[model samples]
Target: MNIENKIDELISLINYHNEKYYNQDAPEISDAEYDNLMKELIKLEEENPNLKRVDSPSNRVGGKALDKFDQIVHKIPMLSLSNAYSGQDLKDFDKRVRDMAGSDVEYVVEFKIDGLSVGITYNDGEFEKGATRGNGVVGEDISQNLMTVKSIPLRIKEDNEIVVRGEVYISKENFQKINEQQENLGLALYANPRNLAAGSLRQLDPKLTAKRPLDIFVFNLEYGQNLKFESHSESLEFLSDLGFSVSPSYKVFKSIDDVIEHIEYWTENRGNLDFEIDGMVIKVNNLKQRETMGYTAKSPRWAIAYKFPAEKKKTKILDIIVEVGRTGTITPTAVLEPVRLAGTSVSRATLHNEDYIREKDIRINDTVLVQKAGDIIPQVIEVVKEERNGEEIGFNMPNNCPVCFEPTVRLEGEAAVKCINMSCPAQIRRGIIHFVSRDAMNIDGLGESIITLLLNEKIIEDVSDLYSIKKEDVINLERMGDKSANNLIKSIKKSKENDLWRLINGLGIKFVGVKGAKILAKNFKDIDEIMNASEEELVNLEEFGGTMANSVVEFFKEDKNINVIEKLKKASVNTKTIEDKNSNVPKIFEGMKIVLTGTLPTLKRNDAKEMIEARGAKATSSVSKSTTFVLAGEEAGSKLTKANELGIKVVDEATFIELSSLSSKEEVESKLLL
Candidate 1:
């Protein structure tokens, strides 16, 4: 076959597999096989550039990086939906619809996906452009970024020009993965999935957007040239038939009462879904009825969204306490009467700081409304002042550190009250915890509990003392056996050989995280070099601001910190750069299917998954016959047993690390095969 024909065939095959994996959730080919096909197509396209098709699957990897997105005026307005917060509000909407369109109206209810709205246009069965829903009429063109979403088909079976509206979103699982990556890099966490999805889609560089996990659920057939549909449900069916991922829970209801009942059911059960939905949309099923109902000034009269109320509970604030952090920042926490919230028991909530408490007038022995902020963090929504009694007492920030009794001071223009004593036991304890975190020195078997125990037992004084811990000392501790103690000592020894960047992050330097540490490690040869660097020099480095530079200089200037560093150096901990800073990670596990089970000693499940995926491995949730390896950790359960029964290779964290260190695919294969 000709090169062009071969390319076409490859594109078709890849697209098919993509749809199967992304949309259908059933894949016929292995990830490696799919990757090989893509590689071949890319090679052919590079050789014969002019012959490359616009609808090729290779476009999903992304194209040229753009400095800015062009603005596009939407042909049809993307109207917002009127919301119904209560059953009465929904009933009122139903009554209004019945008054205009008659009592025989059928309603189609679908999940109101909490995501960014976008419109994709197709011409002659090929994707033409995609734009965001901005101001209802105008939007930024994000065609290149939209093209990277695999669930979005590059070509469809439809011949006529059409515009489809979809909600571009990140799944809850992928959102957690993204946050894990952010935490590993020491970046600020995104508030929620909707904000993250919007930020990702609006990224200036398509390559950056391509790296994010994005999916779309096409809901409305916005425009279809020379096409007619009898009902809204029919149009959705047509779109689904064209390989578009649509709402799986859309149902037609005969009565408004039934619609409200379904909405109530979903309102309580929506947490079971993989994606997020803020509400349920009730739309007139009949297209003719929709036309009769017509559009309002801002939203459609025929459709309304029944929004779920933020789950809140009234609980008594038992007490307010403060805790010292690694940075010596004292944080106020409210101990609450245990209440079930967002499917979990909520016993404690962050009060943020002293100013927050003063502003909210939070008190001990007072009733307060509590809710999960972004459905993740428990927070005090408001105080139930009406229920306050004479016994309730307003809480005050501590004048001194609770643990070390050092005088606390609030700095100018800062909300935090901090204890400046570097040798404070609370600060040291928290600092040691930070030092041994997965993103820092990555010492396994030294969890927060273990660190606390070691501190209270006086087995270790600070982060530097961890390297000197003996297995015999650990074995004598309560609940620690010979094997556990041995593992702990080994992990500490292993961490001493870690790269300079990890050591820098492990230092818990003010305003210097993993990403900043990497930048410093890349620019400077050793920790001493960084310590000696001028603030002006640091400020000039990429991504470093004046505040961060000052913080770095200030942290290194401390005599206590210098003492700790000297101790670490004496213990022979690696403090110098060892590898090329800009080198790409080898895809040692490429084409491998790995399953992770139980509690990993050093890495969280998501962290381990992210690490493997970075090195080109598919980390599956379940063990299967095709699984290349089962990475079993402490307390491994059914998955590990199943892997053994299937005769699949079972590896521990140490073995996994050995496999990851292999430089070539051949080396990885040989290791796995053995």
Candidate 2:
């Protein structure tokens, strides 16, 4: 066969295997065989770029990086479903649906996948566009990113225009693997699979999105040109036949009671599944009935989501221990008997502080009810006092640092007991770890274990000491080879040029977080200016309070901290705030408080925030009456609603961009008036 024919054959073969392995979870060929086929296709495509098919399986690896996602207005709004928390709520929903429509209503039940919702459009059997379900009415186009998902078929068998909706998710196993990789790399681990999947899909680089293990399950046929389906179940079957992955557990039920029973069973056994599902959705099966029932303002009247409550498990607290953080704050943790909760084994939970423990009356050997807060951090919710025996021992906060034997002091009106000794080993180790963290100096190859080794070997005494280390100091250490040591030294040297905000955050000053550091950096030109600033001067800055100002003053007052700053300066570290080159841009948004919501059409949220802040606007997280305007995009949620309710001004990405380009505040006001 010719090269063209060979390429087509290879594409067909790889797509078939992808469907089998990813969609059906059944592989007919070995991974190596599949890989070899893909390699041959990639080689052929590289040799003959003009002959590469649009639906080539090679696209599953990634495409060109996107400058920004374009806005796609969905033909039909992707209405959210109202939630039902109890069996009675489900019954009420059924009664309401039957009362509105007919008594012969049947329901299709499927898992309410805890993932990002997206709409994919296909034209003449080939994938055209894919977009996030932003605000239901509009979404950001993510076609390139969606093409990277192996389960999402690039081409279908049928030859008609179709729009299908699905949930994109990362499997629990993949989530664990990704977190492990993050831990090894000394990066912040993702809080949950849902967030990771959402973030992955929204990545500016399709290659980065492709690196994540993403999967999708199509649930709805939103639009089909000249096609019809009798019921929701029928459409799902059609989707599955079209080589799309559909939920395997969906079932049609004639009785609402049966649906409730099924939901209950899944709620109890959701842990068995590899993917996360926060609830179950019950939709009116018949298409004609759904049309008649229609939708509410924000949700469908023909369907309701039965939300599963946060899973709580009973476990015994074996002991309580306190850990000193980088800032020297003491945090008490409960060592609990290992119990499975939210698909992970829980062996410990945060007791928060002394007040929390005293109020909860938690004790060692006491049976406690533990649950994952937002399916991430494990925390003790309630003490099972009825199950606790009299033999349980109450615990108290330590009076001294466990690691350094230094006296711990609790400040007035503060819950945290802190180790004030600046040289505490625990504090030093944690501080070094923070100094090399991603948001700080971002020195790669310096994970916790490596830092611990360096500290033990006496090669580094503090954060400043890291700058003076030689290649010989690390090359002979465990897990450190010549190349690794060289890379480490280069990374350490490169970090000296980071912006002033990073250095301030790395200092681990009390009450000065990332945002606070940015605020400080914006106000002060260098560390010396900040050190000389009075508490009143700090308090006068935006978002700074008396407590934060006092913390900054007290931190700089210490002779040890001044010595460290001198050392950092002596090593040629950049301490001055780097001024933006675009200084000509007018501060049209000066003194205006803006809240951003949803996905912007042509800008990342952070980029938009930084742009606004640079132009003299404060980007707040929530909408309030005091908000000057809300920059809303597709899928703007509660913030948009609240903005509307409070009569706060709202602007789109276009308007915000226009305002940003205005020469003066008067021009901005004139534009808004127009």
Candidate 3:
């Protein structure tokens, strides 16, 4: 592509990725890839200033502020840092600092946390406001969401009006957990921790933000009216002493060589940390030196960031094969010569789909670049087409399913080809595995190995067969003991008594997950009711989209599915809501709209929602003028904030429990209104 076309394309692509990363919490490309694009665009713009668009994404630090929250105009702008990509750049920076300060300036090097930047202000030892770094000068007020992050202290030790800057992030472990939950719900996975943290903090409901494991590291004491410190490290120490989580290990260096050494050390050890760090921040330690060094229009001249290189390797594509998932989608895998990447030996990489392969012109015997996406899944980057010496052969997708030999089909406007055969063995095996997964039926002692063994022995042909497996049949399998067999049988039986939503989720219905199953179960009394419900009826319910509704209706429409349901019924599995066994209990809070906030004393937030839902009250996520009351718990956040502002009645958890225990709607109303 020519320079102008490439610049335009990069602008469009970066804007799309910015929306994906900041607003949607899903990114199609890796951060390094996005940064390279930005760098190329910037280079082109610098070379040809007339070609730059007035509204180019390169001009912005983040996505536009969301309108769901109040806007906060920053008292002091949150400036970006100029970056130094190599040792020479660092040396140049050190020389500039020395020239400006007229001395050998000490520098503090700290990890540049990969997360959303925010400015938090405190008044008289209490947190007053928290805002994101939206366009640097203006930001969205996210005080409630910030409060949900446990690492941010609501009340500091010092009684002064102060402003601090920090990075809000999610831990790698929590990011994995959240992605797992998303996969179970059949939703698109988040790309990385930074995106997830930003999306979580921007949620309109503080309750939703509370569910995300977000943390913060205070690095800059922007405006401390009553506090005075000589150096950046001293300010960090004061912030840490006031219970603010500070950045991880940092050091003072007198030479640029030492700074480069620290950067190299972290480049090699970045994977060791629980949180993600894209680079290291090198700053002039002395506050006076920083003031003298001063600022540019958008970034500070006193500080520089050294970014790590993208990790990639070149390998040969040995072959491409397809695997059928539980949902019947055929995914292509690239078998390759084993190569080490990100501390793992990767022999296979994801091709994504047929479209991706065709777009990249990937062929057999072709050399291709590869990288570990998110430091987890391996993926092919691009083909080295020049290396092909007329030996590479173009690939074609199979016309039939690999496992069952059933005719495969690609739906219109969709990229994935799927096997529609209900009884495909691959589908059955994967579905059974999912059914016993912890997020589904949660059957203990029933793992993939035992299921595979049972399938091979013809003891179970499908999920329904699992419920009917006898102890004698299980005990006969290899590595099966009497005690193990009994435990397995007991576990299977216990699963039969799980809430109807579990059974619904365990059915492997496409697009209908834990949340969908709960909505279905609450609306319909039993499996039969759900099976008979029309698509319109399903779609009419809250949280049910048109596609999800159609999937549910189509899944139950199949005679084979009906047969499985019959088999499950014959095995005495409870297909109805088990929690609502007491039909005699009155829906005392019927038609009432209640909002729950903060951590309850003895009940989880979800459990509390269910309890209120059982009593015929709607458990709304956000507070508004229409809300009946706010159930305030310890550390009540933004919901309580808005509720009080709107003159809505707010009650303690004790009062909430007392009102819930009331037997009649009249008594409940009287107890609250009186």
Give the number of the best model, judged by lDDT.
2
Q: lDDT of candidate 2 vs native?
A: 0.89
For the record, the alpha-carbon RMSD of candidate 2 to the native fold, in angstroms, is: 4.2
Candidate with top TM-score is 2
Per-residue alpha-carbon lDDT of model 2 for 1-674, expressed as tens digits? 99999999998898789879866999999989988998999999999999987789889888789888887888888766677999999999999999988899889999988889999999989999999987667788899999999889888998889999999999999998998998899678777788899999999899999999999989999999999889999999999999899986899999999998999899889988999998999999999999999876667789888989999888899999999998889999999999977755689999999999999999999999999987789999999899866889989888889999989999999998999899899998999899899878889999999999999999988889989999989999987999999999999999999999999999988889889898899899999999999999999998899999999999999998999999999999999998865466678888889999987777878789988887888899988878988888766867876776687877778678878888888888787676
Task: Answer with 1 or 2, whichever has the higher TM-score.
Answer: 2
Tens digits of lDDT, candidate 1, 358-466: 8988989989999998677999989999998789987878898999998999999999999989899999999999899989999988877789899999989999999
Candidate 2's error at 650, in angstroms? 6.2
Question: How does each model score on TM-score?
Answer: 0.54, 0.83, 0.53
Ranking by lDDT: 2, 1, 3
Query: What lDDT score is found at residue 60 in candidate 2?
Result: 86
* lDDT tens per residue, model 3, 78-118: 76677777889888988888999877689999989988889
